[model samples]
Target: MKKIWAPWRMEYILHVDDSVKCIFCEKKQYVLKETQHAMVMLNLFPYNPGHLMVAPKRHVANLEDLTDEELKEIMALTQKSVKVLKEIANPDGFNIGINIGRVAGAGFEGHIHIHVVPRWNGDTNFMPIIGETKVIPEGIEKTFKKLKPYFE
Candidate 1:
């Protein structure tokens, strides 16, 4: 069996800080775009090169808790995210979803957020299937920089 080396992930594995309960509540430096009620930010651990998350500014765990304005802004931001990614990343398709609970695959179970994953033709390959690893061609910081200008 061949091994995939990802030394960068060690930082996430070793640093276990329980104090910061909700990641969405914190002031994010890498927020790509924001409205009065919602914001979009790059995923620190992305599924693809241009993966992003859109969420309501208020700390709401469920979709039912969102106000009409919040819901509108969140969906607007999600749409904008896809548009921007298409321009910059030129993805063939997208996977946009919101995992409501932990069982539904939400890493931040208490915060409702939508994930926008950009996909290209033949992006899924042997690495993820056989090696159990996902290879991101670009660095997160680099990708953040590429997408930041369009949002601004």
Candidate 2:
């Protein structure tokens, strides 16, 4: 049997604790950039390399709950994230969207955030298509360091 190794996910698998604080709320320490209404941070489990999320600081579950200001700020920060990704990773393309509820694949259903995933021409392969696994080239801390300066 072939094994797909993504040892980072072990934390989520082993700690199954429901008492953990809301990610968007408790993620202040992990924030790369912040505006009054929103923040940008690296996704702990990414769909692709340099995948990051833009989340409203207000902690609303549904996108409809976002204030006009929050909406504007989230979009603005997303654009900035793209710029940072371009400069740091030079990805060929991008995929940006939000998952509002659990059925929509939101791991954190209580917070609304936009996922900005950087993509390259051959980034997708049988590893994901057949094996159902994603391969991230760099560690999150490395990605965080590479992206941190741009937000500052």
Candidate 3:
């Protein structure tokens, strides 16, 4: 019997960084027109590569707490991100979401987000069950290169 190891997860497991601050907010200034939170970038650690998180300029926790304008921006940004991600990643499909809390897997649960992820057939597999990991065939930097041009 043999086992298949996912290369992408190695960087995730071996990779470490200064995560004390909100990376989304920090990376925001690099992007144009999308505002601070609307700034979409490649996920450093992605589910299947080309996974992105879209947020609001002002950070807020719960969805109900979001102002109508904030919600509008978030949605609009999400839609745009989906299109950009599709153009860049060219996956078979996507999985967009917002995890409200730690239990829901927000990571930064206090900051609300809309995830725009590119999905392909058979992406969902036993990696979680078998290896306690998620397999991503590509690297984050590559995804970033594919997506960065769209930030303008």
Q: Best by lDDT, which number? A: 1
RMSD of 2: 4.8
**Which candidate, 1 or 3, has the higher lDDT?**
1
Model 1: CA > 4 A from native: 1-17, 27-29
Candidate 3 minimal-lDDT segment of 10 residues: 29-38
**Span of 10 residues, lowest total lDDT, candidate 1:** 4-13
Cα lDDT listed for each candidate: 0.84, 0.82, 0.68
Q: TM-scores across all candidates?
A: 0.86, 0.85, 0.74
On the 0 to 100 scale, the lDDT of residue 19 in model 2 is: 80
- Better model by TM-score: candidate 1 vs candidate 3: 1
RMSD of each: 4.9, 4.8, 5.5
Model 3 misplaced regions, further than 4 Å: 1-21, 26-33
Model 1 agreement with the true structure over 1-152: per-residue lDDT tens digits: 96534444444434635676777887575799888999999888887898999999999999999999999999999999999999888999998999887656677778899999999998877786667677899998898889998887
**Candidate 1 whole-model C-alpha lDDT, 0 to 1:** 0.84
Total clashes for model 2:
0
Model 3 agreement with the true structure over 1-152: per-residue lDDT tens digits: 96645544545434434474565556553232366344455565677777777777676788898888778777877788888867766779887888786655556666677777788887877876576777678776666666777766
User: Which of the numbered candidates is closest to the native, going by highest TM-score?
Assistant: 1
Q: Which should have the higher lDDT, number 2 or number 3?
A: 2
Minimum summed lDDT over a 10-residue window in model 2 is located at 4-13
